[model samples]
Target: MTDQQTVTYGIDGMTCDHCVMSVDEAFRELPGVTDVRVDLVAGGRSTATVTSTGPLDHDAVDAAIDEAGYTLVAR
Candidate 1:
C-alpha cells in the first residue's frame, strides 16, 4: 500500500451537519481517499482533513468542493 497522505482544505458555507456531510461525501467519492474529517469553527468556515492512500491532487479536491456547492479557500 502507498503511504497515507493528508491534505487540508478550507471549506466555506458549512453551517450545519448537512454541510459537513456534503463535504465528507465529496471526499469519500475520491478514488484514493481513506477518510475525511470536517471541523467547523467561527466565521462560517470549516477545515477538512483528508487522508488518502497516496498524494492527493489539490485541483481535484477544489473541484470536488465546488461541485458540492461550497467554496474552497486556497492554502
Candidate 2:
C-alpha cells in the first residue's frame, strides 16, 4: 500500500483564489506535505485537503493555517 496520507481541515476567511494560494503555500512549506488543495466555500467554511507522506504534525498544521490568515476548525 502507498504511504500517502490525506487530511482535510476546515478553514475560515478564505474568499478567493488568492486565499487558496496562500493556504496552499503555507501547507506546502510543512515537512512531508506532498500536495495541498483548497475547496473555496466563499462566505462560509472552506476545506483544505492535504496530502503527505506520513502522519502530520497537528500543531504545525494549525500554525500553517493561521499563517495563511485563517482559522482552523473541526471538519
Candidate 3:
C-alpha cells in the first residue's frame, strides 16, 4: 500500500461553512487525495489539510483552489 502524506495550505476568502465545503470538495477531486479538512476563518486566512497517497501536483492543487474561487497562498 502506498504511504499517505499530509499537506497543509493557507487559503484566502473562506468565511463560512460553504467555503469549507468548496475547499474540501476541490481537494478531494485531486488524484490520490484521500481526505481534506478545512479550518474556516471569517475574513482572515484559513487552513486546509490534505491527505493523499503521495505528494500531489502543485499546479493541479492551485487550479482546484482557483476553480473553487479561493486562493492557495502557501504550502
Candidate 4:
C-alpha cells in the first residue's frame, strides 16, 4: 500500500456545521490530503483529524485553518 499520514489539529472559532465544512474544504484542497474530519465545539476549541497520503506541511495546515477564518492551536 502507499504511504499515509494522519494529523490532528486544534481549531478555534468554529461554531457550526458551516464552519466545519469550510475547514474541511480548506484542508481538502491541499495535496495528499484524502480526508478531513472535524468535531465541532462551538465557542470552544475544536479538533480536525486529517488523513493524507503522506506527511502534510505544518505551514499549509495552519494556512488552511486561517483561510477558513479560524485559528489553529496545538493540542
- Write down the TM-score of every candidate: 0.89, 0.92, 0.95, 0.93
Q: Write the per-residue lDDT of candidate 1 for residues 2-71, one digit (tens) a residue.
A: 8998888888888878888889999999889998989976466689999999987778888998999899
Q: Which candidate is the best by TM-score?
A: 3
Model 3 lowest lDDT segment of ten: 33-42
The ten-residue window of minimal lDDT in model 4 covers: 1-10
The segments of candidate 3 whose C-alpha lies over 4 angstroms from its true place after superposition are: none
Candidate 2 residue-wise lDDT, 11-44, digit = tens: 9999999999999999999998998888999999
On lDDT, the stronger of 2 and 3 is 3
Best by lDDT: 3
- Residues 1-75, model 3: lDDT tens digits: 898999899999898999999999999999999989899889999999999999999999999999999999976
Ranking by TM-score: 3, 4, 2, 1
Q: Which residue pairs does candidate 4 place in steric collision?
A: none
TM-score of 2: 0.92
List model 4 lDDT by residue over 53-74, tens digit each. Answer: 9988889889878987999999
* lDDT (0 to 1) per candidate: 0.87, 0.91, 0.93, 0.91
Q: Candidate 2 — worst ten consecutive residues by lDDT sum?
A: 1-10
